[model samples]
Target: MARRKKTSPLEDVLDLLAMLPWWACVMLAAVSYFLLHPLAAPIQASDIQGQGGAMVGAMMQKAVIHGLATAGQHIVPLLCLAAAALSAWRRKQRQSLLTEVAQARNTDALDGMSWREFELLVGESYRQQGYCVAEIGGDGPDGGVDLVLAKGGEKFFVQCKQWKAYKVGVTTVRELYGVMAAKGATGGFVVTSGRFTEDAKEFAQGRNIELIDGPRLFAMIQRARQTQGPSTSEHRESAITTGFPQVQAKASVTEPTANSQATTRPDCPRCGAAMEQRTARQGANAGNAFWGCSTYPKCRGTRATG
Candidate 1:
């Protein structure tokens, strides 16, 4: 059995935060600024009722929490807005690139494009088919797998190979299948602007892995142009309205403003939930710093750190 890669929990929280609707953030900011305004003065010890010092302390704590939440509300929404804007811009870029590739004449046209660009193009193709496309690498290298596509709650993995001359091998297809099972994905796709070896096609026969070579990709592209109408973004948003979560954004997270009231908790990479620093109290390396999911008790996601 292959050991799973160690992942951080903070990445999960970030994924959810980035997918937040812009209007939702704006409303939160408005509610905090107007309706839930913090107290002008916190309760002081002297303000306590006769023999009720605990009341004063409780009031003080409540006031402090309100102040922190209020301050954060002002800034967190703005950061969310910025993240949303960046995400929108990147989405447009990917859509446009896919549109171009889908209309191109032959494999030679894709030969000049980089592997990352090819992945984005293929992801857009899947997006056109109503699959929620999430690029694997947050704005950096895609590690190995290129894109993860989801539709109707079923996840499918994709690997794009832009090799012009060489034929894709059986090992590549088998690895994708392995990754699909490991990641709990329902299916997998390996696309290339080149042909696949006979052995590769044979290995993928019974697996839920679809292999697309140059010619087939071109045909799908032509069909897509003929039927493509509504933007994938709008479709995805509509799906979200029907209770499906918006998939991960293609852009890297925008750093929040320095000295702002925003909480800087990182999202867990594995579970896409908020993570906080924690220390082991009774383990072998007790007192070591690591990351754990904030939604603990429910989510057992954790990540070790240096």
Candidate 2:
């Protein structure tokens, strides 16, 4: 039998609460106040004439309930709407950034970034593709993981290596695979701004690990731009908000020369768009080849190839 997933009480309550409509929460709050208020101040109906006392008490209860209900009806909907709107706004910001990164022409812009910025860029790319990304290495060392991507309870680990001068080799992929085993993670990715050695590529085959190098990164960015229908407005928004100038230049990205492969790109893991072979400046497994989303930043999906 399959093991059941366990959730904490708070998680259970929050999950239940999240499923409720805004009006339902209002009703619940009002009803809770009605039930609890009497305990805070006990009703004293005994001081008055029998029927009059009962009537007065009934009136008080009705008044209290109505007042609380009115307050709830007025406040809850606004709070819910604000929360939802803020969520959407943040999501849009992430999406716009993803598009900006994808449309960039050269890896030079990427080269200038600090490691933290690189992690954020990678995380946002996955976020655009619908994964809930958890960043590590902020508070301290993350062993090796820089970001953790999750969806539907499934998790993936990512290690970002901003190495522009060195080639990522088999040992790096081997280390991540070991980490995956220890953490019981579903898969892993090793991303770099350089290339990988042939030995590294051979080691990663059949392992659920993807190696990404620079050119593949640029290619995916281009695809992501295409997928989203690049707009001038997108550039203006990112520029105004972040003060980062957009760098754009068209370069021939690495892809398969084989006619068959060119005709049939693999499907995207996140969006189901076609995946293409883009050689990573530091290709994940092999310095020569890696698969990237043809619709990147927009899809952020990639695969490792032999």
Candidate 3:
């Protein structure tokens, strides 16, 4: 037989606490005292004679009524205090709940930061993308290209710029390119939150340099999240996309023959659209096989067969 699950001791304690019914018990006791105490026989009868023209019995009855009224006055404040204390405690709990929600949202924002904060947001996205990154900051004159990154046997020089409003121009891309060549690096990436100027984009093309703009960066971050699975802190995977076309590889084919028209197309296999294909030069597909989608960019579905 399956082992029985053990009951939690804390759950029992909470049940006992709920059963106390402190307010109900206090009210019941107060009301019982008020009603029962008045039921006692009066010290003197209505027929009893007066001490000095005033009836002694009437005077005693008046005193008893006054005593009951006085008791009610004292009880009212105590009940109010109890109610106020309960309200305050509940309010505190509500505030704490709100605080936790806000913190979760903030963490998500950091993880979802555009490509501009690329290296810093590296923990979730790029790590899943097969890139390892190290964050660095100091008084260096290179304007914070401090993150060291590696993928496979190659090292990539990376610089992250978190500018949202202004466009990053040719100067930034040029600087990274120079650094890449100087270090004899395989390639380099300059990631930014905002758009790059036309000149900056032109400069990046054809060089061993890549520019990751806001949209691409956001998409990659989101994809990384999906690849990793669900998480309690979605902030770490904030870049994961909710509704968008599937991601394509950086390069469709690593090698092609002089007359090879069988380039891998980015298409959807199911819908007959052009499918984006990513293949390494030395992979199983090597020289002859080419993958095409039944659906194009709209679907980007894929199928591969020998």
Candidate 4:
């Protein structure tokens, strides 16, 4: 038979002693009341002179006894409170080890990986979390947005720039908007290892685009790593229901930009969004300057012909 562990004798004594103050105060008060019993006779006495010197002497004796008794009552309670605190300290020490263990688990769950792998991981992870993935890539004539994914029948295009350390500016996200419109995507995702400029983040808000920067990317990766098993692609192969093209953007195309806020291109003939600078593939103006619609995969509108 297994023996039950017994509490230390010292701990047991401290616990009992700690609770004694509350009871001790009550006991002292009772004792003090009893010690003042002789004082009750003074109330019945008709007058001081009628009671005589002997009564006065008895009253003084009662007062001294009651005073000492009251002092002991208060002092004993304080001592009891001190003991109780010491007992609580020991209990807290025992529970602290358990608390540390729980915290360690949480910390490990939020600091798993680096930022460079975020974009690839996020889309893959999102698919694992039950979404369809549509990867778009391979040298067409728009930005290098390589993927689009969907969940619950809702579509979102993804632009993955593997800039491991540099900040992504507004121009990159602006290009994604065009691809989103072209694909008729419900929304867009721009995932990068570096941070987004304030302007870029502001452009994403209220738009159908979401920006996942370095910090958020790292956190998500950490969460994914904590639940480690396999790369996201293997787990959710069935849910990835889209057959997307691997089209690549051509060379750099020059588009007109007059004012800072003005549209880079006239308008996307396909999606009606503003066209941006992009190069065409296998054309005499292949490397020449032309404006292409911001909505590439969905719209495929180019101003090169215009």
**RMSD of candidate 2 to the true fold?**
13.0
Cα TM-score per model: 0.59, 0.46, 0.40, 0.38
Of the candidates shown, which would achieve the greatest TM-score relative to the real structure?
1
The residue pairs that clash in candidate 2, if any, are: 102-221, 170-200, 194-281, 194-282, 195-282, 201-285, 211-284, 213-280, 214-281, 224-296
* Residue ranges of candidate 3 with Cα displaced over 4 Å: 1-118, 138-143, 229-306
Q: What C-alpha lDDT, on a 0 to 100 scale, does residue 79 get in candidate 3?
A: 49
Residue 25 of model 1, lDDT score? 42
Give the per-residue lDDT digits (tens) of candidate 2, residues 1-306: 011257787444543343333344455556655654554443354523446678777767766765666665545444545443443454455555656667576777567666656665666665444445655542234457777666434567888877877798888789778878888877788877778899988887756677778777666556555654424323322322222233231222444565645434544544435678777674355566667877665445666666
Of candidate 1, the 10-residue stretch with the lowest lDDT total is 248-257
Which numbered prediction scores highest in lDDT against the true structure? Answer: 1
**Residue 22 CA error for candidate 2 (Å)?**
19
lDDT of 2 at 116: 54
lDDT of 4 by residue, 36-121 (tens): 44434333344433367888886677666656656655554554555556534433432232233223434232233333223335
Across 170-221, the per-residue lDDT of candidate 1 in tens digits comes to 9888888777777787677889989999999889875667788988777666
* Alpha-carbon lDDT, every model: 0.64, 0.59, 0.49, 0.51
